[model samples]
Target: MPARTVPQVRRWNCPPVTRENVDWAQLATIDLARARTPEGRAEQVEIARDAMHKQGFFYVVNHGFDLAENQRMIDIASVAFEEVDDEEKARYQARIKETGTYLGYKLPQYWVIANGVRDRITHYNFPRNVHDRNHPEALRPYLPEIQEMVEFTHCTILHEVQKLLSLGLELPENTLSDMHPFDDTNHSFWRFMLYDPRSEEEERKTEGVWMKGHADHMSFTALWSQPVTALQIKDHDGQWRYVKHVENAVIINCGDFTEYLTGGYYKSAVHRVIKPPADQEGYRRLNLIYFGYTSDNVVLRPLLESPVIQRTGLTKVIEGEHPTMEKWRKTRTAVYGVSELKKAADGSEYEIVNGVKVTHHH
Candidate 1:
């Protein structure tokens, strides 16, 4: 008997996004080097606060990271995703479905085919905890450099960003620091994504989108390797716009956990990626992302003492105890799975699956 051959789903052709359709605007950009002086520190804090409160997304430059290091990581990513064979890629496939462990590689189109748009993101996920000794053997070759990137981002970039966020919230400078200490068992992870170039015919079929509008479940997200302009964010006016990419800049955004901790003072931005125009679509897209998460043992609740919370009287925040990362993730996933219909602010009912809000066209 011959082995069975399964057919792959046709690549999703995302609707083409044009300048007329999307309200393109320059997102707020902050330079981390501003924190060196007292006056600059205060200005940077205010800038961070404004960015978060208004849109929950911004860009950072002069973040003290070397561009050569970034290029090196991208080189490694090219080898991992672009150069590897399918059989070799399968060696690091994550057991997210069976065990809810979010480590290792996730092949493209592994989840729902929403609106006939199958996501073509193939990624490798690395946890923030360096002591996690169970990494797949195939991923061991590139683990050291990846680990170095994770540590530098967590300790240097995210740490400083959190301090600014604390200042923005009018809380003690170190208020948000304790939640993600070096020794704490944080669930933050670094993700390296490869968006292979798609044909114009594929784009026409599904539209020019790669990812649908979604929010992350972390405290804050740090984005780099944005050599291309495909990422977009839903702004305050409910308009979709491109998050323009600038050379040597890191984009940051607040996530669900940050929103919860701030008692709704800051919001979790809804963002997605769209395929480039016909001319630019030929080049492959590589993304390096680091998301900051509260430690596993930390309780996710509103910081009641926060001046923003006090003034706003937003007492009711996240309900119940999000006891641990394992428990919270499982519980949330279960809730997103069973819920059939949910009402949005406009009273429109949409379907939910696996914690992703699905929007459909009539």
Candidate 2:
């Protein structure tokens, strides 16, 4: 028998779409380069504070990773999803149903998008400590690069954002970052997402929505720009606006955990993925994202220690017992896409777990 040759996978060259064709959101851009100096850090803090408070979403530039670095990660992720055989991917399938952890491969059609229609997205999640879990054979060769990116994202970029957010809250600079130590066992992960193209019939069935509008389950989500035009966020006026793609920039958004910790001072961003526009509808949408989470033992409650939270009288005690990070993360992950969603009066779907309500919008 002859040895089989594996075809090479090429990186996706996604060009930016014309601005006039898209409804872009005007998001605040934070320059991380300014955070190097004390004065600059102070100014950046105010900018970040306002951005978080107003929209809970923003763009970050000059965060150390260059275009080539970003492209490298994207290239490797493409290989993992494109070149790897399905049988190999199945070996590391995530047991979200059995264990509630998202550390492995998630096969397509595993999630319910709408009306029992399954989603056409497949992804592999790498933990903060890359070696803590196994990966597919296709990704094994690039583990070193993957680990480097993961560490840089957590230690440098994520920490810098945490510091700004903490100072905004009038707490010690390291207060928020300390809750998510790199060496700790947390639910944080670097995800490689591949949104497969769907046929027109499938799109009609899903109502053109790839993923429903919902808040993230973690504290923060950092998404590297990939020029896809499918992401949209709900604005203060309750209107959905498209998230614009910036070159070599990262999109940061607060999640449910951040909203809980800040006593609702920082709202969780409600966003969704829909079918791409006419110009880009034929291509697959690839995304590289890092989900930042607190240590497993951190309680899901307001930080009453913050004067801002205290002064605003938002310190009302939550009705249920505070669930630790592990419990909250696992429970949410286990029920997603599997639980029956109850329709709310406002035409949204919701499910209450542990006294907290999780809502999904169309």
Candidate 3:
């Protein structure tokens, strides 16, 4: 049988709606269906590559995944989060803040960045190919539906994104794909997020910021079109602009891993969530995100031989050998304001922010 054609997307041009001095630029959109043929694939690569260089983020459309199915999973997650008793949730609380382990559930407002209130976000993470022993019992019953979503996104969306990136980098077609082959070893995780709307009093205390600025440790992060608009990304001008959500589109952003691989040509954009608009203030927000990491066995280093890498006059300072996905996560957990007691691989414990460890107590 002939290979099926990928879905195609027409370029969309529209300015993002903005408020409060935040410039929301219209992000370029690429259609994944354009990637099935060699000629179309080349065009997609250029589009994706340009977006990476300019903003390190873009909206992907025409990806052959059911938006309704994604919403269905989110609905199920909502029930699991709201209906589940607090006692059961406590059992599955994330160990990252304490033990530096990245698994299970993280209660709301568990991360306190700066001298502000704890973030108004609760989340759960599901790793690809979960180990038998580490699986959380709380999510066992819902695993079937949840796992389907995770695998489909990985195979259909993330996989193609990586291929385009590799092509744009002027590397062998399989350079990045080879590093992240379709298998159990790929260190990807799906995050289910619930953002509680801020009340009048609580919004005043927050001073407009809901979640603090930070960068992801993975190669890239794909966020589904969410119902509310609170996410923002820092541009090259150092200004924070709302990452406007496009209908039926998935927002993709580079992370530190991509930065290291490209020798800083591709940067990891810092982003945060701010207080919702007055109309959306009382409504809860649900977001589905996938953080795709390089395969565990792939050692991260700059692809120095690529012509783009050479022409960009990029330095090799940040291009040296870097930790694999597992090590990076552990390192991130250690310093992500989890605990002053947390230590890195070198046995040094340090907290960037003092007196503001995020705890479950509200």
Candidate 4:
């Protein structure tokens, strides 16, 4: 009798957490007041340091970005995604499913270096405020309204980031006083609009890995996950903890450059996406914009010299400052495309910042 009714299994399955289900302290990134003062900013940086150095991850509340702007970006993202024609959507379905991650429009299975985990999603990339206008490739041009919003978000974040850097290191205001917004390449931000549109065929794939566990290759990542439960962060216990999209708050995690800078004092957090449950089928991840930065030169090794770090074997390495603008043009493919290195199949290449896998589906 039981043989008459075996049901089908789906590709992705994840649990959701309502406000009633969360452990607020476990998810708290900082003390709210410290989030406001430079000293408080320094403490958050210390958390970034602690997270990077020991835990390899931390939640951040109020590091200094405009929450209203972030929420607006989210609104715009939904419009752009829903506007795609069926043909474009179909073309992307395969690739987005292949990487099982939302790297871009359409990607091949092996396009990403992290090939064994959740990869189902979409990404809407936005250009840097100053760099976009001057970028030779920026002429492709998005819609006027879209471009304006993106530019606004990009510049606003950059200002906040600079302030964070100054506060994190306890530097004097304008310590990077000489830095320019459009210096070309040393610092750049890219935003992606990601979502998951579950089609029935996706329910039938065998041994499917939705999105693989990986690290952001840039210095730091500021992400506003679409209030969905798929985004998970690896905790100190090696357990994947779901990062709830807190309303009006952005999540900041350490990235490659951020880690290498403190001589490993700060760590590049590892993360991945998990599929949502079947009953919740057809759920979509709205928009997640990541402000990604690249040093002008790949070799600007982070100098690890904090007093605590100096107490250890870690000393300081003053690698030359990066070249700034030319760096982006040459390294664009590596940053935006999937990893090309041999270890790609095993995800090793995906972990490398400069020498990461390079695929060209975007």
User: Which candidate gets the maximum lDDT versus the true structure?
Assistant: 2
Error of 4 at 98 (Å): 20
Better candidate by TM-score, 2 or 3: 2
Q: Candidate 4 on 130-224: residue-level lDDT in tens?
A: 33433112222333544554444445543455445544454543432224244454445454455555444443441222465666655656666
lDDT of each: 0.70, 0.86, 0.70, 0.47
The list of candidate 1 runs beyond 4 A from truth reads 1-23, 134-139, 199-205, 319-326, 330-362
Candidate 2, which segments miss by more than 4 Å at Cα? Answer: 1-9, 16-20, 315-317
What's the number of clashes in each of the models?
Answer: 8, 0, 2, 30
Superposed Cα deviation of residue 333, candidate 2 (Å): 0.9
RMSD of 1: 8.4
TM-score of each: 0.83, 0.95, 0.83, 0.65
User: Candidate 3: which stretches are off by over 4 Å?
Assistant: 1-22, 97-99, 114-116, 130-141, 319-321, 339-362
**lDDT score of model 1?**
0.70
Instruction: State the lDDT of candidate 2 residue by residue for 294-347, as single tens digits.
Output: 999999889889887877756324477998899888888888877888989999
Choose 1 or 3, whichever is better by TM-score: 1
Candidate 3, 78-101: lDDT as tens digits: 654666677877777777855555
Q: Cα miss at 240, model 3 (Å)?
A: 1.3
lDDT of 4: 0.47
Model 4: lowest-lDDT 10 consecutive positions: 6-15
RMSD of 3: 7.6
